[model samples]
Target chain A: MNIKVAFLAILLMALITYIPRVLPLAIFRKEIKSKYIKSFLQYVPYAVLGSLTFPDILYSTGALTTAVCGTVVALILAYFEKGLVIVALGAIITVYAAGFIL
Target chain B: MKKNFLYGLKRGIPIALGYIPVSFTFGLMAVTGGMPVWMAIFISMSNLTSAGQFAGTYLILHGAGLLEITMTTFVINIRYMLMSLSLTQKLSQDMTLPRRMLIAFGVTDETFTVASMEHGSLSFFYLLGLITGPFIGWSVGTALGAFICSSLPEALSNAMGIALYGMFIAIIIPPAKKSMPVIFIIVISVLVVCILRYIPLFSSISSGFRVIISTIIGAGLGALLFPFEARDNNIQEMRE
Candidate 1:
């Protein structure tokens, strides 16, 4: 990529990305009154997290077996209510070890 | 305000740690693919996005037009609108327009998740502090990867791939375990993602759109099936 072209592309990408993030926060100043909407907003985080994790996590380590091993370790640690760092490190370590084993 | 800011900074440590490997990978990919190191760092610093930056950089490397890059980034990042909207309900009353705009820039999936899980309304300082660490981590990690490409062992870098997802699991699973509605939301979302991901008919849908669609269905069904009580929905009351 030419430096000039890359700069334009990066600027365009940044602008497009920033617009979605800024628009909602800019436009919706008042609290939404609808219970349905509120409930939906409340659940959005979990839904997004859930959706982002599966299928994607399975492919994160580039191998199905290692990814599954990492995921199971993460799930178990998370199930046991481990801290964020612990669950993450556990999964990483598991994937590394499993990569060696399998 | 200072206390909240520091608390948020402390809370952001894990998220910052999680971002390092991912951004490092991004840096590695961009540089390895012939993108200038400074450009990779600039993208990380300016965009602060994972998927969008990767896709945009890929297209740029392949000599895609500005329009294509713009459209692709817009599609990938459209999910942030939902996150920002959801956050509108959580913002503290003191949030002004400038502050809101600044905070909005930091609303990545991980930051949004952590912020949304807070017990009460979000203050600007807290949100600012929350964003600071991850921002630094992302840029610094990218710089390292760009400068030190191929030096890190493959095994370690590959293993680090699961760290962010593991952090996501850590965020959602504990709450899901306690609440039936949360479990339903998670299960539905996961199921929706699986369907879109595996079904041949849905293969054409991009990954970014897949996340947005799954989120809407899962959260919409959850809202219908388990509406919050007036007490729970009342943000003002909770703030007090």
Candidate 2:
């Protein structure tokens, strides 16, 4: 790809990404008043995060077995209220261990 | 002001740690796709999105037209609009227009989750602090990954690849455990995503649309099935 084309593409990508994010904040200046809308918004974070993690997490590791191991370890650590980094580290270490063992 | 910023920075550390390996992979992929190190870093800095950047870079490398790249990014990143709109429910009036715009630019999935989870209204400085750590981690990790693409062992990198999702799991589990509705929402959302991913016909739907559809259905179902009681103190209070 031409250097200028690549650079322009990056700039364009940035613009598109920025527009979606900023437009909502700009237009929805008033607090959302509808109870149902508010309730739906309340659930958006969890739903989005949940969808992002599953199935995708399974494919993140080198093998599905190791990914499951990592996920189990992560769930345990997170259940114990371990910090985010600790949970991530626990999962990564477990995956590496799974890799070595298998 | 400094205190809020510092607190947000502290909260941002784990997110920053989570971002490094993933951004590193993105950098590695970009270079392997024939992009220069600077170009790869530039993309990370300009666009903090993960999937959008990966897909955009793939299209760019394949010599896709500018319209294709823009539309692809728009579809992948449309979720941010929902996230940002939700966040507006929590923004203080003191958070001016300019500041909101700045904060909006940094609203990645991780940042949105973290910020929305806060109990009270958000501050501009706090949002800045929250975004800065991950911003640096993402950009710097790209630089490192681009520079050391050949040297990093595959096993170690693969191990690190799990960290970002692990972070996502960490974010959702506590809340899910606390609330029955949250648990249901998460389970349904996951199921929705899985069906879309594994079922032959649904699997063909573009990933961007899959997430949008899943989030809408999951959240809509949750809202319908378990409407919040009007008596419970609303969680969306904005600080003056």
Candidate 3:
């Protein structure tokens, strides 16, 4: 990509990415009054996190067994209410160790 | 005000830590794929998105046209619309339009999840603080990877792949354990995404859209099945 073209492409990509993020917050200033909408908004975070983790985490380490091992470790640590850093590092360490064993 | 910002920065540390390896990989890929180091860094700085920027950069390297890039990024990032709208209900009443717009620029998946999971309404300074570390981590990590132009150890780098997801699990599991409804919502989302991913027919749906669709199904079902009482709708009072 030419330097100018690359810059332009980056700008366009940035603009497109920004639109979805800004538009909703910009337009919906008033608190949503509908109970269903409020409930949906409250649940959105958990749902988003759930979808983002599954299947994708299974492929994170590029090996099924190690990925599963790491995931199991993460789940256990998280179940115990470990902090984010601890859970993340526990999983990483699990994957790294599993890389050696299997 | 200063205290809130500092607390937010503290809360953001793990998120910033998780971003480094992923953004490092992105930097390595972009530079090795013939992009200039500055350009790769620029993309990280300007976009601050993981999958969208990665896809957009790949297309640029392959000489895809602007229209293709635009459509691809739009599809991938449309999930942010759902997240941003959700955030509207969480913002403190004092949040002004300019502050909201500024904060919106930093609304990636990780940031949105962390912010949404906070106990009460979000403040502008706190959010600004929350986004700062990850922003710096992302840009600096990219610069390092682009400049070094050498791969990290395979095991270490690959292990880091689970870091963000681990953070996600950490965030969701405790809440799910506490609330049966939360557990149900997560299960619904996981089931929807798994079907979309594993079933060949629906597999063609892009990852971005898969997240959006699954979120709607899960949260929508939650809304229908367990509507919030009027008092529960006030996030600040709920926190109290």
Better of 2 and 3 by TM-score: 2
Off by over 4 Å in 1: A1-17, A24-29, B1-44, B47-150, B230-240
DockQ preference between candidates 2 and 3, better one: 3
DockQ, all candidates in order? 0.51, 0.47, 0.50
- Tell me, by TM-score, which candidate is best: 2
Better of 1 and 2 by TM-score: 2
Regions more than 4 Å wrong, model 3? A1-17, A24-29, B1-44, B47-151, B201-206, B230-240
Badly placed stretches (over 4 Å) of model 2 are A1-13, A24-28, B1-40, B48-150, B201-203, B229-240
Give candidate 3's whole-model lDDT: 0.80
Indicate whether candidate 1 or candidate 2 has the larger lDDT: 1
| Candidate 3 residue pairs that clash | none
lDDT of each: 0.80, 0.78, 0.80
DockQ of 3: 0.50
Q: Classify candidate 2 by CAPRI docking class.
A: acceptable
Candidate 1 docking quality: incorrect, acceptable, medium or high: medium
- Model 3 Cα lDDT, one tens digit per residue, B2-81: 99899889988887887887677567667756688999999999999875786688668767777767766775576577
RMSD of 2: 6.4
